[model samples]
Target: MSSQPTSNAPVLHVQGLGFGFPGHSLFQDWSADFPAGLSLIQGGDGTGKTSLLRLFAGETAPQAGSVTLLGMDAVRQPAEYRAQVFWRDPRAPWPDTLTPLTWVEQLPAHHPRWSGEAWRAHVAGFGLAMHLHKPMYQLSSGSQRKVLLAAALASGAVLTLLDEPLAALDKPSISYLLQALEAEARASRWPGRAVLVAHYDALGDLPWCARIAL
Candidate 1:
């Protein structure tokens, strides 16, 4: 693993970022500085929470301005920038034929800090151990979400972008995820490591290093 950058430097820096759909504009000259640790992106529906995450993840390009992740241009150096982050869109379609275990096993190869033991532990912690072999289409919504969460947490990416992370989660699973996120923050294995969570509902007692509302 590479050494972490200075704590004072922002892990993610969005400067004058602008994006819009065909008929609606999401952000106009939006800017923010996200330091290491957990940050919450809270907003109601139609507020572009998911779009913002996609921009940060380099999955969507900004119409104007720039995004810098760990000193790399998010647009110009997309591959290098994205390689340091793990982003999973809840609304994105998945391959229904693949089993959760197979998906998890394949994703980590791209992540330099991938840990097989961590992946298995998160799978069990999120209550997906028994359903690992089942095709994704067969798993319940919550179970499918657990599979994705397990993969993201185990990826060990410096930047983790989670869109609507708390959606469809039961009480126990929510608690488990919260604990895991807290541990990730404290460990700080990657100096510029950050977890950016986009959600519309009240987080209620969850720990957050910073909070931004759109």
Candidate 2:
């Protein structure tokens, strides 16, 4: 890893990252610096985009190397490292009886900087208020995704990772997401925050601070 930073101070720094499955290698000795702002990780399906996000989330341990967010090392100080990072696999299973409203209500206890106002506003904006009380298993795929969308923006985590956020979203919801992301950048709020989205294409024409190809 280079001791010099070519850009702004990194919110997330990856050095010598190496990982892979049996008989199939994905990344080896990869290093990069992610500064504060929205960054895109673009690649085709099955190209290890989700795998990389999992690595960053500390959900999957890397075979070798380090993932550092803010200043905490994912391997050395997991509890403190994850505290400032928000990453939820959209396809992850939920409790049978869990409701979006209840689940979201508990997020703040885990994420110190979580914003209730942002959550409520996004819930309303995404038309998810009507389904908040319903069981997660009962909600439509699109509705479920909207819940994650709302939470991601409201979390206020220093590092936020969303893999394929647009996967099952509705047209209006997609439009709202684009607008919300753009507004987030324009507001210049959370300059220390780094939002990374894994997608096959750019999110509209929004000005992305960085783009990494997996």
Candidate 3:
């Protein structure tokens, strides 16, 4: 809805964040600012890329420090803060047995900026027309991930977090996703939205707003 020129200010701000599993520490005194537009969180396996995204999404609270989005405090105003963020872990199992169409239909209530037009466009672009009616568990791996990928693009949440976006995607689907990200980089798509992708490598020569090497 907002077509204003992108500001250099951080859409997502983090400070003094810390986290770790039982035996290993992932982050200590980690701090970073993520501006709106396409950005990459690049690292190899076991580098905590996904965990970092979880922290940004507020799904996994940091052991210390703070996170804020668009000046919305993720700690004190969690519901409001998280509503503006769109994040889904592709590695986890989905307990929702609904069809992709049904699942996406619920986005508007949770995501104030959810865009139906963008959803329709991405669904078509990803060639997920037929799979829309099928239960997510019934779809192929590629199709299942495509459903989530399309939702991530169309959710219109202030911050969209994508982990390993290229996984399970076919060649054509990958091409479509690349085009979408390129458009975002050009300021021609998903305006006013900050998207962070956690992956091992850059997908293309995108003019990323930020590049954090986890």
| N/CA/C clash count, model 2 | 0
Candidate 2 segments exceeding 4 Å error: 1-7
Expressed as tens digits, the lDDT of each residue in 1-214 for candidate 1 is: 2346686888888999999999999999999998888889999999999899999999999999999887788888888888888987876677878998778777767788877887888977888878988998888888888888888888888888888887899999999998888887787565567889888875776678888999
Per candidate, the number of residue pairs that clash is 0, 0, 0
Q: Any idea what lDDT model 2 has?
A: 0.86
Q: TM-scores across all candidates?
A: 0.94, 0.94, 0.93
- Kindly list the per-residue Cα lDDT of model 2 for residues 1-214, writing each as its tens digit: 1122234679889999999999999999999888878889999998999999999998888899999986678888888878888898889888999999889889999877788988988998899878988999899888988999899999988889989988989899999998888777665556578888899988789768889987
lDDT of each: 0.84, 0.86, 0.85
| Residue 60 in model 2: lDDT | 87
| The best candidate in terms of lDDT | 2
Relative to the true structure, candidate 3 reaches a TM of 0.93
lDDT of 1: 0.84
Q: What local lDDT does model 2 show for residue 44?
A: 92
Q: Indicate which candidate wins on TM-score.
A: 2
Better of 1 and 3 by TM-score: 1
Q: Better model by TM-score, 1 or 2?
A: 2
Model 2, residue 205: C-alpha shift (Å): 0.9
